[model samples]
Target chain A: MSDTFLPVVAGHAEDGRVAPPSTPRNVPYQNGAPNPSAEALRAQFADAVQRVDVVWGETTVFVDRARVLEIVRWLHDDPTQQYDYLSDVTAVEYRDLDRPIEVVWHLRSLPHRRFLRLKTLLPKGQPLAVPSVWDVYKGADWLERECYDMFGIRFEGHPDLRRLLMWEQYKEGYPLRKDFPLRGRFSRSEQLRQILAQNPEAKYSMEELTVLEAFDELSLEQRNRLRSGEKVGE
Target chain B: MATTTRTIEVELSTTGLDAQGRPQRVPLATDEAGNLVPMTPAPALEPELEGEHMLINIGPQHPATHGVLRLVLELDGETVVRCVPHIGYLHCGFEKIGEYRQYNQIIPWTDREDYLNSPGNNVAFALGAERLFGIEITERCTVLRVIAMELSRLISHCVWLGTFCIDIGAFTPFLWIFQQRERVYTMLESWIGARLTTTLTRVGGMGADIPDGWTEDLANFIRTFPAVLDECNTMLTKNAIWVGRTVGLGAMSADEAINYGLSGPMLRASGVAYDVRKDFPYLDYETYDFDVPVGQTGDVYDRFLVRMEEMRQSIRILDQALKRLPDGPVNVDDHRVILPPKSKATSDMESMIHHFKQVMEGPRPPIGEAYVAVESPKGEKGYYMVSDGTSKPVRWRIRPPSFVNLSAIPKMVEGHLLSDVIAINASIDIVMGEIDR
Candidate 1:
């Protein structure tokens, strides 16, 4: 990551030549015009761009999971396609357990005024992992973590890929997965018992305790348990 | 422990009198001609202390946090060395619950997420669902939605300004702003019969049309609202204390702001003229004449200025919407999504069947997905929904602006004084309901 912060060049709206943008009218379903950049992406990374579908006036491009990082970096750095904004990072799990999970990234090219959806499928049998776009857009930090916490889709290159909305010691499995029950896996009384049984001292993570130089003062068994990766709730 | 000395430069008003009216020693010294000039003396040098830092935790429960947001900071004396924000205390899995509910049934859930911007959230979700169902709302419905959006923006920004003043030690503005907020709420109550948790919009239209004389009330608000805002501006915009506390704190450049996905007032304050209403232009916003306010040197001060200006701009849009609100049905004519009138449903066989089917199994969109974003008071709030040709959405994701904006708290709070952390966090305008959802 670069230490220096460089401002992105202003968008097309800054130029006086182009007409002011207006609301899109009568947008067709499934056959609307695809973003020009989608074609440009296919031409640039022929093998990586799997499929481009225009649904409800938005273009969604399916890409190979391995090259997602390279593609996102190029999109951010490329002058004509400066998708400097990362709108959202989320994963979708189909009810049919046999189908592959689709991890979605919503990227916007402010300069070009284009919205694009990038999806990569994680087959059921294989590990649910994909490259992180945190290197390209720093906004992906919490988003990717939330995706992992909810859907168990691991973002491979995320620096601190821990549970976001859930506590670090939470052992409820992925909440948004197809197999996860609506009220949760544990009974209400069990959930209350688990909550009450949690250790107050574990509120501060091991990393935070290290910052206080208090980690070395822990008991031998506690240190051994922490070293063995035993979480508080476990 | 070793004793350490840290010299801090504090900006004090040159009033020459303390709170008790006693003559106080000012930072400025009088020259021979009795002219007040800045004092120049040899600065005190401090000895380096041992490498010891203190950890401070502020709120998952503290009032100044605005909501249930916990920020754990590692401080070196008074300055923050590092900030690790812990959120999700308000998380109830809104998105997870959304997958189980039908499209219209999900409208009430939207209200609970961003409670402050409930009407705006309803409109945004309706727009996304309408797109998924390939339905265009009526003209009157469009104008009504615009009204709801601008009204919600007004109230949300009012709450923000009020709480922000309270956070920064100003008590008067909080009362003034909340008074203005109550007026908007009154109009909302008369229109939708609900105040905070207003499921104002249905998939193709509104839950109900505005009550009689509601436009006059709105017009009255639009006229009187700016005066209160101007009063607030007079109180704090140039106040030396407000400037001293907020100026140059938690600054972000335009490029950095965009990279961090900051939106709404947070992005506008960084000199980025990106407003979703202007750029994306849903709900016929393109036809409305309103300027997108941008700020220079994005800081807490700039965020304040941007939000204040945005409330004024919202009034402008509301004024236009009121004048151009066409006379037509608020709901669409499609029986698949909207039910026929109760009078007609009882008389006509087909209307009764349509009503029964709609009530039994909710209206389902085709197999597709749509992501609709709106210029919410907080920022670019988006609702992304995917339909699998079912009554309930396959996946519903809320692209929360505050969540992304709050993620950059570490960058903003680091190297600042511990007290300024509160000010910086307030400027982010985060709603934990939306962030943790």
Candidate 2:
């Protein structure tokens, strides 16, 4: 939403800097032909925000995290750019880069038939916090929570921020990050067993107890006592 | 069979009761006595006045709910005060799995995303990967892809209409729709090796040529579909009860619909003339002549009408595609990406080696990302894939239309009766496999 990120979509970058070469041969429409209204809106967004980077291949407008909520509010409330819908909220982990994660928000305006992509980059190991867009777009609540649950990026003002896919007692680190092992054998079913074992009051069947203790060295009486609801631990 | 009715007295539980002339337990008090007593509690319960509403969970297993979606519904009697959708019950970590498998290997997995529209999923992923690979498909391959996709669309819509009517208490329509759908599955089975999870499209082109007698059979199927659709529409479309249940129910404004990312029939029914095929033309969609239907009221009835009109339009597109069907190779001549035919691989040594290498070491796509969206039966099905100059994708994400469209349900049924929730959900045509994936 800044002046630096122009209305024109940036092409894919070749050398990883300064933007990619523009393929004008397949340009869907002529650029700078008849764009008085769009140009004015672009200038307005530029005046309101900080730096904007237009990635070439993917048309994204990178805005600072602090001003994202303000930008989204303007985009949704403003009659000229009423981007009322939040299509997606996803994050990418750039392990090779100095700033590791980039959160992307895809917004669409029905009346104008226009699409906008907003992005913010977070430093490595830093907890990225952005204002929740739930008040502006009701559909964004679940998506923002899912983003947090997967990428560990926090949405500070979310009404009910909780792990969506993972269980209530999952203690493992974020599973979708690049640092997580891809093919490692870690069973969530097993994790649930460990949790149940620690809580003596937790009711579980004998068949379930047997399945949980199969991987570990548990005596027959200890397993039976646990299944029969007897407190086995001191 | 005449019978006499008799009343029997039964004893209810008395475990929590105390011996007294009157009943012991009070509504909000711990004990039966008239005197108030403090209850052992943890979290504080917000005070609710008499006749105030509270939240109730409808699923993870309720019959009305689809798959494993759980809805937290706040209600005042039968009217819904607030609604929240809880998902991820069927999540299998597909996006994470994509990072480990090769590009071609992911095609089979996409079939499970929206199992009803497997070919559309295949084409969307193939198109995304093809864009990254910078490969152009052959004319025959494009036509074949359109044919497969359109057939899949018809089948998907049939399944939706069938199940929707069933939800509204009509069972016969489901059988009628399934009869039509079964024919489609049989046709696809003959073309592709598999019926449901048909990995027909490859990155650069189609996997195989059309089987013998396929065109004549397809034409026969198309000729008979319009009559069947008209018959079904006549039976249900004008029914007073059906209209009463659906018309002006679950209404969403055009602005609200778009803001919630509702696409496909939901957006079109909200009076938006936005279809990926028309707006963002992919494959040979630009060449096909079809109408983009729009609804006036953006209600459940409008959504149903849009889908019915869309089925007619799909038939029109199928007729044109059949007429424009080309005679040539289905697979592109990009030996680097396409595998050789099985017959040729056995006879020719050069063909045999190419097949081996193409299967083992998948084609390397340039390091970049591409997002390609297609108009499936439900809505906009977009595949966003990022390649890292390797056979496997670095990231693969699906923008499932059902998942995004289902987000609009709370707004649709905010003040509607509880029973209307089931009808609205049916009209939305959500597939839980796609939503939870």
TM-score of every model versus the real structure: 0.92, 0.78
User: Residues B1-437, candidate 1, lDDT per residue (tens digit)?
Assistant: 11112111223455344574333434677889987766876576755667688888898889999889998899998899999888888889888899999899999999998899999999999999999988989999999999999999999999999999999999999999999999988889999999999999998899999988988999999889988988997788756678767877899998999999999999988877787887778988888878776777788988987788788889998999999988989999998899998999989999999999899998988899989999999999999998889899989999999999999999998899998999999999999889987
**lDDT (C-alpha) at residue A60 in model 2:** 56
TM-scores of chain A across the candidates, in order, are 0.87, 0.62
| Model 2 stretches astray by more than 4 angstroms | A1-57, A73-85, A95-99, A109-115, A183-189, A192-234, B1-55, B340-357
Predicted chain A of candidate 1: TM-score: 0.87
Candidate 1: tens digits of C-alpha lDDT, residues A35-105: 98899899999999999999999999999999999999999999888898999999888888998999999
- In the range B1-437, model 2's lDDT, one tens digit per residue, is 11112111112222222353222333344376654554545575656566666556678787677677777777777788878776777887888888788888899888998999998888888888877776777788888888888998999999888988888887777888789899889998888878899987888887667899989989998999887787777666655456656777888887777767788999888766667786556876866878677776688977887887788788988999999998998777887888777899999999998888888887888766666778999998877776667888877888888887887788888898888899898999988888878
Q: Give the winner by TM-score.
A: 1
For candidate 2, give the lDDT: 0.72
Candidate 1 chain B: worst-modelled 10 consecutive residues by lDDT = B1-10
Give the Å shift of residue A205 in candidate 1: 3.2
| Model 2: CAPRI class | incorrect
Find the 10 residues in a row with the least total lDDT in model 1 chain A: A1-10
